[model samples]
Target: MPIVQVEMLEGHTLAKKRLMVEKVTEAIVESLGVPADKVTIIIRDMSKENFSKAGKLACDQ
Candidate 1:
């Protein structure tokens, strides 16, 4: 089984996430020759306030 982890800022709709996972699964299946059921996807939704870049909080930017 292949596991994929994705982390992005929160605010995406369920439809977008569903499409993203579908595409990701297709890619993994094609590259690894693995079944779709064998691919695992873990999505982490992060808050902008908890993320920062270049000494500036994401929420501040």
Candidate 2:
């Protein structure tokens, strides 16, 4: 079994998220030779304020 975790700033559309999940699953299955059913994907959405870079918050960038 393969577990994939994707964390990003919130606000993506549902269609985009669906496409991402599909592509991620395909890549995992092809690379690890695992069945699609055995793959687990976890998507985490965080506010821009929750992320920072180079001493600046994402929301401030």
Candidate 3:
């Protein structure tokens, strides 16, 4: 089994996330030799305020 964790800023549509999961799972299955059913994709969404870049909060910058 392969577990893939994807963290990104919030606001992506459900369809985008679904496509992301499908593509990621397919990549894992092909590259890592994991079965399609055994590949797990976890998406973590963080608010702009909760994410920082270059020492500044995303929302603040």
Which candidate has the top score in lDDT?
1
- Higher-ranked by TM-score: 2 or 3: 2
TM-score of 1: 0.91
Better of 1 and 3 by TM-score: 3
The regions of model 3 sitting more than 4 angstroms off are none
Best by TM-score: 2
> Which stretches of model 2 miss by more than 4 angstroms?
none
User: Residue 2 of model 3: what lDDT?
Assistant: 77
Clashing pairs in 1: none
Tell me how candidate 3 scores on lDDT. Answer: 0.90
* Models ranked on TM-score: 2, 3, 1
- TM-score for all models, in order of appearance: 0.91, 0.94, 0.91
lDDT of 2 by residue, 2-52 (tens): 998999889999999999999999999998899999999999999999999
Model 1 residue runs over 4 Å out of place are: none
Which 10-residue window of candidate 2 scores lowest in summed lDDT? Answer: 1-10
Residue 52 lDDT (model 1): 91
